[model samples]
Target: QQQVKQSPQSLIVQKGGISIINCAYENTAFDYFPWYQQFPGKGPALLIAIRPDVSEKKEGRFTISFNKSAKQFSLHIMDSQPGDSATYFCAATGNQGGKLIFGQGTELSVKP
Candidate 1:
């Protein structure tokens, strides 16, 4: 089990609203969890991450809530803004391979 699947292929949220996306994985061996944010024509950058050891992790307006037992995780954006519109990806990596398995991709748009 080394695959992670994400949903909603795309999402639209009003400015100052909350944006939520979900993801699930099958590999329990994964130890590293990370989210990447990418803008149009730009490479994805590490936005935030959480390990199975922690139930949740947050940074600024970005938050990652994870459920290890359920093999699921989600990303939440608070006070979403037009500037925050971008493609979000959920990924996981095991100690054996530093390489990350990413979700298909989720496009988030915050309308002003």
Candidate 2:
């Protein structure tokens, strides 16, 4: 029950449109949920994260909505831009755990 599932293998959005990506997990032990964004030929960087105690978190144009009872989470990008084009991944880890259970990445493209 440590698996994280993500959907919308690819997404295309207009520059001023909204981009939404979803993720779900099976392990209730997971405490930390972090989203990462990766560009071509580069390492993934942390975008935003949330703990189980928090229902939602937002930073700049990125927002994460978490549902503890449903064991699901989603990432919403407001005012999607061409600069936001990248591969995003959602990951989860338990308390004091170093290994992150990552979801299948969702490739997002924002057209100018």
| TM agreement with the true structure for every prediction | 0.97, 0.97
- How does model 2 fare in lDDT? 0.95
- For 1-112, candidate 2 gives per-residue lDDT tens digits of 8799999899999999999999999988888999999999999999999998989999999999999999999999999999999999999999654799999999999999
lDDT tens per residue, model 1, 1-112: 7789998899999999999989999999988889999999999999999999999998999999999999999999999999989999999999775899999889999999
Model 2 TM-score relative to the real fold: 0.97
CA deviation > 4 Å runs, candidate 2: none
- Model 1, stretches more than 4 Å misplaced? none
| lDDT of candidate 1 at residue 108, scale 0 to 100 | 96
lDDT of 2 at 71: 94
